[model samples]
Target chain A: MGSHAERKRRDGAQPSARVPSASPAAAHAHRESMPDGAAPAVPGLIRLQPSSVRAAAQTPLHLLPCEIQHNGPAAVSRFFSPAIRPGSSGPVVSFRGRSLHGEEVTLPSGYMGLVLREDKSEGPEDRTVQAIGTFSCFTLWGLEAPPGPNARMHRALSWPSLATAIHAPVAEEDD
Target chain B: MLSHKKRPAEVHCDQWVLVAPESVTDLPGKTENGPVFTRLHNPRTGEAALYLFDTNAQQLFEVKAFHEEFHSWFIGQTVQHDGRLLLVTPVDPLFMVLYYLIKAEKEQGKFQPLDQVVIDAEFPSCSMLLQCAKLRPFLHHVTEEKEIGNKKFYKYSKEKTLKWLNKKVGQTVRALKIGNVNVGARVSSATFVPGDHGSDVKEEDYICYAHGLISEYIPKELSADLAKYLKLPELSASLPEPPLKKRKVSDGPVEAEEDYTKFNRVDLKTKKTNSKMTAAQKALARVDKSGMRSISTFFGTKAKAGK
Candidate 1:
């Protein structure tokens, strides 16, 4: 009987082992004897460490496959060209912002673009968004939304049309 | 005595022409000076030349052009003409349009191009140059609208605001030099406070909370050590233990019932009916008694043979 009781205690002491008790009172007593925050003697509950929660939440999101090649303040300007406007002879797209010297530029066809400028804010709620630039009929190249906290900009461009135009296939398909 | 030496004709390209000034000058000539016009050519292709003219002779004459590889740093950006190096200035498109109009008038003999004009002599830094290029088009667009409104009255669209957030987020994360233990972990979700249905009242008066996640699993102790090394404050408090409960098991009736189950009925039958049985029969009966004893032992009970 002494050996049997000792075996029971040994089995119960394992980290992965679970003890079956007839009464809640006995189970409660058993749990009190365990070290603080240890796994519950009962079967259902799991005690996850706080660090695990933080670690799980910090996982990085997948990055989209796209590259931004240009640099300089006017690097974005390459995407802009003369856009056609009704009853307008020259380039139609006009940039209206504080920094501009007030000029009107026409974009060539097949050029489409957009620009967004956000002011620094103490919080996300206090941030201001300004449409600093835009063009007509541009393609979005990547995912619709930003990937993570690090993704400060989201840009997309049309793919199939651009690809087809750049790489001519042996047989042309009907548009 | 006349010397028989011929000077090289100044290199000129369509749209851009380079002319050496009689003297050095500053950039962006004034309306009074007859600035030296030069021919500028693209080193590559060498196809078209830009016609370069300056109105401010004093500024233009004072500056010298030197040959430097034209780094097409920004598109549609114009720089000052160094002897070979182009020093681009932040020219307002409106100013350019006005300057072009005045030049047209001079061509028609209605006015004279400036002979000697003063210009701002400071050369802009690279960043400043980039800023100028970025802001130029927007200013020109606003001017063309001819709207007489307050300069401070600006409206931001939802799309524009989100785009700004995206850029700022990227910039902040890239700028942060987190320690080695958290290298693969990145900022996952960032929330900004004072957000009104996705709009901000003021840019500066916002609070940003960024959460980062670990990509790989590490031992809990190691992870804790890393967090301690990085000096991250704990966000949650440890919980206290729950109270214990006691149970009372009765000893009288329960003990009697348990003993009754421990006895073997076969042993009682043999004791009552087999007083004169043969040795074989006794041995067989003993085997049956032993089987009952084993069953009782397996359940952690002492076996009782008779009633």
Candidate 2:
């Protein structure tokens, strides 16, 4: 993962990779060194690669109870994927000796989960994130027992209908 | 517990994994004609927001990214550091146009051609709003129009606009009912199930809730007018604490009173997000909080206490 990401950056094939937290000072310095010499601003809209954005294969995911500090490749398939077993109540797994309770959660209908990739290349125009992938479900892991109604992810998922209610179009003319 | 056949090298690039309307993948025939992403004035707050205009600029979509702390995404073979889930939903383009129309009302304070009223040097692309197909059909909802010598002119009409907005609240109220959204339940945590306890919530609560959602799309002043038009009651003082103070952008030590996705309006590369964060949030933004427990930890304690 890192090698390809690095190769893309080196090859100037920067996609719309979102750099979340480059402090003002660091971004300011980087801006000075940047060849185009402009602020490395995240564009307002991520250009979608129309050619590649078809139905993608279902991607497996795990919502861990604890956060992992690192942000790169891991042997999820080799060490972790094989361990997800169908427990009596739900799926069960263990990582680092702690039992993880899991439940499969699907996004509410009409919504699709996406994995969008971008890069650090410069001289930008229509920067893209076509390493694009999609999913509709993931296994949410909790400690001891899987999260129920109280999980934040569940609450967050409930936001869409409200958003629909909020942004849903009104009549062009009132009777 | 962990094994690596070949650990991948350090990836410097960041990834954005989000949940968007399935229709986002729908592209027009021309590649150059895919959804046009641009910044538009958020009518409610007068702030710039990232918006996408569908091909032909007929429909508007707001990219909403819900955020929580210390979260990241593990894509197929890679890990994305940012954890917020983005959503793109159709938004009424007229709400965006209203920002400019209201501004023109305040500045020129007179009826003007739509083209002249919609101009904004700050967001040069805002002119694209003039091209939206719905602009003509829906312009009458918020404005009074007059035809003179085959040319049509318009002026922002507060009365008409408020009535239109009231209808918006009414429809939203009906939708909340249809969706069984528990409007009375304060979403204080993820464990909050709408119907679980907020069931006895009043009809006023539904109207108020819908009003709040609609308020996010119009100016605060107009939102107040809509509230008056709807005759919605003031937030009763019966709650546990004082109402959250609404602060101006320059005010000091303002709490982040609402959604974390306010970052959607900001340039992601820069850290000075328009976030009016509290000390804890400010600290949270700077810290590297890997290995930290998620909100589920709190759930454990809550369950233990309940048992």
Best by lDDT: 2
Candidate 2: tens digits of C-alpha lDDT, residues B110-182 = 8788989888865666777788776678889889898888888899999888888887888887887776655
Tens digit of per-residue lDDT, candidate 1, span A53-110 = 1222111111111211112122233333332222222223322111111112222234
The lDDT for every candidate, in the order shown, is 0.21, 0.56
Steric clash pairs (candidate 2): A15-A118, A15-A119, A16-A118, A17-A118, A17-A119, A150-B190, A150-B191, B44-B218
Q: Candidate 1, which segments miss by more than 4 Å at Cα?
A: A1-64, A68-135, A143-151, A154-175, B1-118, B122-307
Error of 1 at A163 (Å): 35
Per-model C-alpha RMSD: 42.4, 10.7
Off by over 4 Å in 2: A1-45, A119-122, A172-175, B1-13, B28-32, B185-191, B197-199, B235-259, B262-307
DockQ of 1: 0.02
**Best of the candidates, DockQ:** 2
TM-score of chain B of 1: 0.14
Error of 2 at B125 (Å): 2.5
